[model samples]
Target: MNFHPSHPLQAFWNLAAAPIQAMALEQALEHRLFTLLAQPATAASVAQQLGLNAASTAVWLDLLWSMDLLVRHVPAGKAEPGYAASPLAARFFVDASPENCAQSWQYRARSLARFAMQWCTLLREGFEPDGRTKEGAAASTGSWAQAAREQIGQEQRVVTAPAVLHLMDALPPLPRQGRFLDLGGGPGHVAIALARRLPGWRGTVCDQSETAEVAQDNIRAAGLSDSLEAMGRDLSHEAIGGGCDLIWCSSVLHFLHDPQAALSKMFEALKPGGLLLLAHAELADDPVLAARVMPFYAGVMLRGNHLPQPGEVAGMMARAGFAGIHALGRIDFPMAPVWVHMGRRP
Candidate 1:
C-alpha cells in the first residue's frame, strides 16, 4: 500500500466543521425531497418514481415529515400510509404549482450550503455583490436575482408582505418628516404600507429597472404615487441618496454579495442620528439556526445572496458604523431563529 504524506491537522480540522456537515446533508435531503414532493405523488408513488422500496420510501417520507416538508396520511381503517407535500415543498418544488416558490429560490437553495465560501474572498478583495454572473460584466450572467425576478413574477407571494408589515408595525415609529428609502422594494408593498401609515413621510422605491417598474406599478395601485418615487438603480455601485432620513432595506440585504458594504452605504445615506431598519429573514442573525430548517429557505438567499451568521446582524451593523444597533423580534423559520436589526447612524 502506498502511503501519502499529510500536511497539517488544520486540513482535518477543516473537514470536521459541524455547520458544514449539517448544511450539506440539509441540501441533499432538500433536493431529493423537494423534487419528489413536487411530483404530488404518494410516499409509495414517490418511491416508485425514485426506484426505492416501500420501506425506504417511508423513511424518506418520515424525514420530510420530521422536517415539516411532507405530510403522511393513513386513511381511517386503511393499511396504506399516503403522503402529501408540505406547503413549504409545494410552494417552491412543483414547477406548475400556482404557489411555485422554485422560481423565487428553488434553484438557488442548493448553491448556498455549498458554494458560499466564495464570500470570504469578497471580503478580502473588497468587492460589492452586484447580483452579476461570472460572465465578466459583459452579457451579465446571473443566477439568483434574475431567477428570483422571474419567479417573483410567476409565484404568488401573498403572506410575506403582510408578514413584513407585521414585523414593521412592531417597531418604534419613524421620526416625523423623515424620508424613508425602500431599497429593493419588491412591488412597493412595504413602502406603500409605510407611506399609508405615516402621511408625513416620503419614500423612494429603489431597485433594478424592472423591479422598480413593478414597485412603480404598486405605488400607482396604492394611489400613493405622489408620495413615492421609483428609481431604477444599482445599490452595489453608487451610494443611496443621503437626503433620506430613514432607510429601509427589506428582504433585499441577503442577496447582496457584500452585505456589510451595503449596510455601510445605508449608513452613509442617513442623516446624523438617522435610522436604518433592516427587515429581512434574519438568517444572518441566527448562525446555529442554519442547521435546522433555514437551509431550505436560505437556499434561496444562499444561491442569490450570502447568508452571514444569523446572529451576526449586530456585528454587521457595528462594522457599518452603526450605533445602538438593536436586533429584535425573533421569529421561527422552521426551527431556526430569525431577527430584525435596527440601527442608528451616529
Candidate 2:
C-alpha cells in the first residue's frame, strides 16, 4: 500500500505555528507598520520611525513581505530594498480607507492571544467558572464596557453591518414608520443602518446597561438620534419593550446561558404578526469553515456561554411560539459565514 506518512507531522507543526501568524500580524497593526509603509522605506528607516530595534523590526518586516502583505523595492543607486504596503494592504489595511479592516484584525488578534489558548484548561475545568465573566467587562472600573463598545463597532463594520444591510434589502416589503427593535444589539449599528434605509421607521437597541451607553453614542454619531435610541434591558429577566414591527437579533443568541428563555421573552415582546430575525453561525452545516473558527466561539462557550448547534436555533424558535419560520441561507461575510433564521409571531 502506498501511504504518505511523512507529512502527518507537518499538520501538527502547522497548527502549532498558527498563533504566531496572528500574533505577528497583531504586532504589525499595533505598530501601524502598514500605515507607515504607505510609502516605501527601508527597514532601518521604518524601525527608527516606530522606535523598534532595527534587527527585530527587519525580521518582522521581512516576514510580512514574505506573506505578500508588503512589497519590496530597490530604488536606483540604493543598496537596501525599501518596503511598502501591498495592493491588498493598501485597500483594506490603510486607516484612511472606508474599507479598513484593521480594527477587526486587532480585535481578533487580542482576543485570540488572550483567550484562545485556554482550550485545554477549559476542557479540564468543564468551562469557565466565573458566571459573570462577559465580554467588554474591562475592569471593576467599568472601563471594559467601553472597550466592548469599541470591539462591537469593529464587529459591526467588518461582519454584521454588511450582512444586515444585505438582508434588509432582500427582505419583503413591510410597514413604514414602524417600531423596530434591535435585541441585544451592541453599539446599535444594525439599527442605525436599518433606520437609515427606512427613513420613516424608528429604532430601539436594547442591551445591558454598559453596552446601552455605547449604543447611545453610536446612535448619536450616526446622526439618527431622533430616529433611534438605545435602552438597557436584560432579556433573561427584564422585559423588552413591546413593539409593533420588526426585531433584529444577531450574534446574541449563542452567548446567552439560556437562549430559549430569552427567545420566549422576545416572542412576548413582539406584536401579533410581528417579525423576528435570529441570526447566528450554524457549525454543523459548514464543517469546513467551522474547523477554522470553532476556537473563537469555543472560547466563549468555555466562559459559560451557550454555543448553539446547527438545528438548535430553529427548534428554539418553534418552541418559543414563532410561526411562518424560514431560513435565509448563509450570508458570506468578510469575517465568517452566518445563517439567518426568521420567524413571525402568529
Candidate 3:
C-alpha cells in the first residue's frame, strides 16, 4: 500500500479563508484598481498613481495575480514586473466595459456578507422583522425601490437581459404584435429588450411606485416611451393589470405572501392561449446545484419567504388553471440558476 500525506482540515481552512479572498476583491473594486490595471503597469507606477504604499502595493499586486484577477509580466533587464487586469477582470470588473457589473456585484456581496454574519444568531433565536419585509408593504416596497435605483438595473442590463433573451429563443413562436407584462420588472430592461426584439409589441412593467419610476426613466432612455409603460402598484394586494399575449415574471414569487394566489392572478390576467414564462430558483436535489442557489437565498428563507422545491411552481400553475405546463430547464441568473416553466391559459 502507498502512503500519502493529507490534511483533513484543508477544506475547513479554505472555507475560513474565503473572506480574505472576498476582501481582496472588494478592496480592488473599491479602489478601482482593475481600471488602472487595464493596461500593464509596474507596482511602483500603480502605487504613485493611486497614492498607495510602495512595498505594500507590490505585495498586493502579487496577491491579485495569484488570485488570477491580474496577470504579471516581466520585461528583459527590468528589476520590477508589470501587472495588468486578467481577462476575467478586464471583461467584468473594468469600469470602461459596457458589461461591467462590479457595482452590482459589490452590492450583493455586501448584503450577503451582512446576512452571513447574523446567521448564527438567526439560527438560534430566529430573525426579527426588519424594514426589508417585516414592516408594512410600504417599507418593503421602499427597500426594493432602493435596490432598483442602485444595483437591480445594472444586474438586469448586464446579466438578466441576455439570459432571458437566450431563453426566449427556445420558446415557440410568439405573436408579432401583442401586449406583454413584465411582472416585478425593475428598471424595465427586460421589457425593453423584448420590445426591441418584437417591435410591434407594447409592454408594461409593474412594481412599487418608486421602482416603477426607475423603470419609466429607463424606458424613456431606451426610446421605448411610445410602446412601453410602467405601472406602480402593490402586486400582493392590488391587481396586476390584465394582459393579452405574454407575461414574463422572474424571482417575484419568492417574496409573495401567497404564490398560488399570485399564479391564479396571473392566470386571470392572461388572455386565452396566452403564454406565461415564470423563472425562479428552486431547491435542487443535487448538492452542488443546491449550493449554487441556497446561500444567496438563505436569508430570504430565514425571513419566512418560500423557496420553492423542484416542480413545486409548476404544480401551483396547474392548480391555477394553466395548461400545457412544462419545465424549460435552467438558466443562469446573477447569483444562481433559475428553472424556467412555461404555461398557457386555455
Best by lDDT: 3
Count clashing residue pairs per candidate: 14, 1, 0
What lDDT tens digits, residue by residue, belong to model 1 across residues 242-291? 87788877656666667888888888888888888775565443356544
- TM-score for each prediction? 0.56, 0.87, 0.94
Q: Taking the tens digit of each residue's C-alpha lDDT, what string does model 2 give over 1-346? A: 8685667689789889877766777787788788899889998998898898999888888888887889998999999889999998887777887767787677667767767566577668765356545553445326535655765576676667777988887989887778889988877877888888889988899988888899899888888999999998767678887864888987777767788898888898889999999888666656687875576677666666776777788899999999999888878653557788999999
Writing each residue's lDDT as its tens digit, candidate 3 over 232-279 gives: 977889998785699999999988878888999899999999999999
Model 3 residue pairs with clashes: none
Assess each prediction's global lDDT (C-alpha) against the native: 0.65, 0.80, 0.90
Clash count in backbone of candidate 2: 1
Query: Considering summed lDDT, which 10 consecutive residues are worst modelled in model 3?
Result: 128-137
What is the C-alpha local distance difference test score of candidate 2? 0.80
Q: Sort by TM-score, best first: what order?
A: 3, 2, 1
Candidate that scores best on TM-score: 3
Q: Give the better candidate number (1 or 2) by TM-score.
A: 2
TM-score of 3: 0.94
